[model samples]
Target: MSATGAIPVPPGKAGKAGKERFDAAGRRVLLVCVAGGFTTLIDQSVLNTSIPALRESLHAQPAHLQWIVAGYSLAFGLALIPGGRLGDVRGRKWFFVGGLALFTVVSLLSATATEPWALVVSRLLQGAGAGLVNSQMIGTLQDVFQGQLRARALGMYAVTGGLAFALGPPVGGAVLAAVGPEYGWRLTFLLNVPFGLATLWLAARHLPRPRPSARDADLDLVGLLLVGALTLALMLPFVQPPGWAGWLGFAVAAALLLGALAWWQRRFARAGGHPLIHPALTRSAPYALGTAVAMAQFGSSLAAGLVLAMFLQDGLGLSPLGAALVALPSAVAMGFASAVAWRVVARFGRRTVTAGMTGSALTMLTGGLVALWAPAGPLPWLLALLQLLGGASIGLMGASNQAFVLRHAPAEAAGVSGAILQMAQRIAAAVSISALSGVYLRATGGGGGHRAAFAWASGVCAAVAALAVLASVLAGRATAREEAAREESALAVTSNEPARESTRASG
Candidate 1:
């Protein structure tokens, strides 16, 4: 290892075994880092099955319920960019350890909260910590692996995330059924503490601290506030039914904040100051379009899960355990698909994402039809089939979209790029869930009838899938162009190197 803390690869055949050993070490570090991400996703999904329990126990209003869920997501999304940028400047390991510590403490707080409002605050803090931890994970991966190893590591990361999300409902349901709702849901939060501590130990032992680059800039405090306010303004109306006045106030404030953020970023860039995210990175066609596609996929996928859960529990009168069992096929399929995603991407490149989105759209449309007309006796079977398709779609798209967006990103900017990608995803999940919940509640009128609501949510999922298809296609084109340009540039440099060396020798 270099004095700067970078792992130097040995040259030629003599160093081959050393390189292999280094690669193995990197994989271990990746697993440790991904554990944090897995835990975060579990935290998000485990709460789903427990929502009814929370309402009954806490006497929570609909608004309170929404906040309890959306609060975590909003804080997570809001903090990611700044968190990632902060990691870039101050060291990801430091930020990661601090974030894990905070998350563990808040998990305990969430488990102990007796009031709905108290739980909401705890969830927000927990998500803030999750954001900080997650912001650094991909950067850590980028730091350790290269070439084909990097691709496989990223695919594994995606697989872990998918499994965590898929496992949450079943795990949460089992707990709720086994221990009873009052205490079981609380145990879900408490479960993170030990896992977090173990992961922290591994990270401290395994993670390398590379020297920070000169380009690492100060944390954009003003930009952070602007983004936080912007996200809040945009997301608030979804969670709480804002009246006309409230909507107007939020809209005006959102516009003003957005404009202010843009102005500040441009001014900072012109002054040779680093913004939270470099303006160029945002403008890059492949990255921007890939981010949109990822957002759409995440939104639709999360909403679909919620709607399916409702369909099973309410529309068909299944117990939470039964519902979880019926949903298991999707998770299984997702795991299978994730395992092979890298191979598919290697051969087909961005077309894999386009194909995945297309499949997702078809699945949602099919699911919606089934929800509208299929008999309850056949509902479980049909939903399983649909989930199989949906899970496969998500598994195929998740890692590919992430890798595509960051493929052209500068090494130093990996943290910020990853932060933006994940922030968009979490934002999409929170907003879509809020909108779908509103639709479900309004459609059912707080009753057992949820067919109409399920169909509506399915339609929205279909629309999101369609958007993803468009974005993925455009992203594919942009990615191909970018790759080709990069190839040509590399050839130019390679072709000139020999000539330059020959000239020097003659001189």
Candidate 2:
């Protein structure tokens, strides 16, 4: 009804107006969500450029340096599932704000820290906050968007991330070079302060608060502990240069803790309790396969970047800014590739991912060969070209992989799925960086073995890419079959519902 007590606007017009309003709201929400993630991404890139500067200024040991790089990732990976569950049980709004606030404070701590251990501890805490922030951002997206809108939002998420990757190196290098070596690394962390506050303001103003869960439901604290313990045990050996015996001990502990986590969560949920992450997610073939692929992609890529950074800065004597310039072309190509990724996914499905993995494998192999023999002057261009190809491979697969994983996840477990995806990536990153460092250290004999180190790292990346190809193929087949079964089941239920209702009314 109109205010004049006459016929309302046409039905089509009304719907169109409503849709436009909804879209406006969605866009604002998406910006807020992406902003939260942007801070973390910038922090990641800036820190990478500052690695050598930190080493020199703090007089940090090899182990200390590794912790500085890997600690936050380890902590973030461990906290993600539990943090997501907390948001599901509590309200996401407060959790998001809390996480951002914590992140800001810790960023300051990390920036101001005078000692190596202090910086490491602050980074660990910052990672935990980041895990919370990411879980909430993803959950918020799932809550607000549906169908085509959801797909677009997720694609935009990937694009924003790609842009961040492109921006990180140049931003870090510029800041580092401007501030000089002593204080440049600190500025990287400090830069997050304003962005964090602004994001928090937008989130509070625009994002809706998630409804709290039922009173009886809560996160499985014991399961979270077990998962955390398992993560810590698995990560410890990697960061600290633990030998074979130490690795064996930690591996055993990790296995035991993992088994315990599974058993506890199963029994808890059987008693009508909420598990940290639903066991059904584990049973989802698409999620499992996609997660494996994501792990490989992140691990190989992060390790490759770290190894290359080392080669450029330490081995080749290039300044941070110079190295960033050399790496700029790949990042630019990646941003462009990511912009069109959703279209590729819509058209090609899982085959696109397989192709990307194949490209990744070839590029890494080529990079390895180049590292071994290519001359210095033309070497940067060749490496840039290989990196550009590799970046495209990553952009093409990553968005689709995430979408596929989320598509199969239950609506109530949105937070869990997001956490699991991120956790895999971060864990892979932490472990891979450590492993690559070991390879570099051994190959260089404590000096300059840039070529050998790069060759070895690229080989590992190629192997991972090959495995990813197999995983993506298997997952695509499984997901197609699963979708078909679901459609049939839905149709069956729909057909039977009318007859059942008729029978009930007659009775």
For all predicted structures, in order, the TM-scores are 0.87, 0.88
**Best candidate per TM-score, number?**
2
Candidate 2 per-residue lDDT, tens place, 109-186, comes to 999989999998998899889888888887788788876677668767766766676677778778887888799889
lDDT of 1 by residue, 69-141 (tens): 7778878887787777676666788788888889999999999998988998998899899888888787777
Point out where model 1 deviates above 4 Å.
1-24, 209-217, 244-249, 410-412, 446-448, 483-507
User: Model 2, 339: alpha-carbon shift in Å?
Assistant: 1.0
As a TM-score, model 1 comes out at 0.87
Worst 10 residues of 2 by lDDT: 1-10
Residue-pair clashes per candidate? 0, 0
Stretches of candidate 2 exceeding 4 Å from the true structure: 1-22, 209-217, 445-448, 483-507
